[model samples]
Target: MTHPQIIARCHPALEALLPKPTAARAALPDWLRAMPSEAPAETLNGDPVRTLKHCPPFLDALSLGILIPLATDLHFDKGAVSWDWDPPALPDTLISRSPIALHLPEQATGAPYPLAVNSILKFLNFWTLEAPSGTSLLFTHPLNREELPFRTLSGVVDCDLFRDGYVHFPALWLDRDFTGTLPAGTPIAQVIPLPRSAPPELTVTTMTEAQITANRALQTDLATTPGTYRKRFRH
Candidate 1:
C-alpha cells in the first residue's frame, strides 16, 4: 500500500497505544527518539546526549515509518519545533527552540511560525538540497549542530560579500517586516545579497573639510552669542 494511506490508518493505532516510543527503540540515541514533535514528552537533541532511545525516532516512528519522507533529517531536525521570536538560548552546541525559516508562498490564512537558530555557527548549505522555486526552506537543526558550531556564521546559500559578511546587528532589527532591509532575526541563510561591483556612474558623496569646518564654526558662534540681537561678524 502507498505510504500516505498506510500512515492515515496507522496514526490512530499509534495514538491509541501511546506506548513509550523512546523506550521501545533501543538502537537510537535518547535525543533521537524522544522528540516532542509527536507527543507530550521530554525534549530530545537539545544538547548532545549519550545515545538515542526510542521505538521509532522523530519521523521514523510515525505510522511504522511508512510515510516518513526521504531525507527526513533535512526536513525535521532531531529536536523540538517552535515559533518563538526571541533568539533561542542555546549553548554553542545545542538545540534551542527554533525552526528554520524557509520562505514559501504565503498561506491562505493564519500567522506564520517562529524559527530559531543555534548561536553556534555552522555550514547550512552543506545540509541543503534543491527546493521548488516557490519553496522557502527552514533548516531544522539537530542538537548535534551545537557540537559542531560552525567556526563562523556560515552561509548555506551564496550571498553578496559586503552585505552578508560577518557583522553582528541588533536582534530588534530582525523582527521588522523590513522593506529594503533584512528581516528581524533573518539568518545568514535567507539574505538578499547585494551586487559585488560598483556602477559606472557611481560616486562617493561626503561633507567636504570646508563644509565641516563651517558647520562647527557656526555652532560655536551660536553657542557663544548673546540672546539679544547681535552685531553681524565681518568676514
Candidate 2:
C-alpha cells in the first residue's frame, strides 16, 4: 500500500548543514531506550510489573509523527540564550540570520499561561513543510519530552494550503535556572499530518446490554491478560 508523502524543503546551502526532520521512533529519548519492558518492584510483592515500555499507546504516541530538530546549538547562561551557528551566506532578503526569535511578553499579556513575564522563544524554521492535499499538520511539543527546559506551544496549519511560509514555533522557557547547551539536532517539535475533516458528531446515550457486556469483557481482559491490547487490538 502507498503512503502519503510529507515533504520538507530548505535552501540548498542549508541542505548539508541543517539537521533534517526525522521519524519520531528514531529519536526516542536515551532514558526510555535504556529502560526495561518489565522490572521487579518491591511494592508489587517483588512481581515483574510492566513499565511504560510495555504500553503500546504511549509508545505509539511517541512514534506517530516526524520530529523537527533544532537547527543550531543553543546555550543558556545567567538568563541569556545564545547560539554559535554561522549559516552559509545567502541573499540579504532570505531567511533570518539567527536560528531563533522571540515573541515579546506584551504579546502574551493577560494570557492564562503561567510564565507571563518571560518572552516566548520561537524556534525559527528554515525548512518549509508540505503535506499531501487535504491534509493539515499538527505542530506540537514532542510527546513525553519533559526533560527539555522549554515547552513548545501547539498549533495546526493546513500545510496543503499554506506550504510556502515558515511556521516558527513559540515556546515557553520553563527552566529559568537551567544553564547549559541544548545541542543541535535536539528535537524541538513533532509534526503530525492529519486529514482535514469535520469534527466527529457527538453522541450521549446509555449503554445497551451488549455494550455493557463488551465493556465487562474488556475490563476482565485488561485485569487478567497481559498485552491484551497489544496482541488483540493494536494495528
Question: In lDDT terms, which candidate is top?
Answer: 2
**Which residues of candidate 2, in runs, are more than 4 Å off?**
none
- Report the error of model 1 at residue 188, Å: 13
Clashing pairs in 2: none
Off by over 4 Å in 1: 1-51, 55-129, 143-146, 149-235
Count clashing residue pairs in model 2: 0
How does model 1 score by TM-score? 0.17
Question: In lDDT terms, how accurate is model 2?
Answer: 0.89
User: Per-residue lDDT of 1-235 in model 2, one digit per residue for the tens?
Assistant: 8676889999888898899999898888898989998899999899998899989999999998799999999999856899888987788436897999999888987977666226888999888999999999999999988898889999999999888878899999887777899999998999998898898999999999999999999999999999899999999
For all candidates in order, the CA lDDT equals 0.27, 0.89
What lDDT score goes with residue 73 in model 1? Answer: 24
The ten-residue window of minimal lDDT in model 2 covers 111-120
lDDT tens per residue, model 1, 1-235: 5211110111222233212212112323344445543443347645443232322233233212111111112222333222323433435433322323332323312534332332221221211122223222222222122321121221232222122222221111122222232122222222222223344796888889999998788878766763211344421
* TM-score (C-alpha) between model 2 and the true structure: 0.95
Error of 1 at 107 (Å): 30
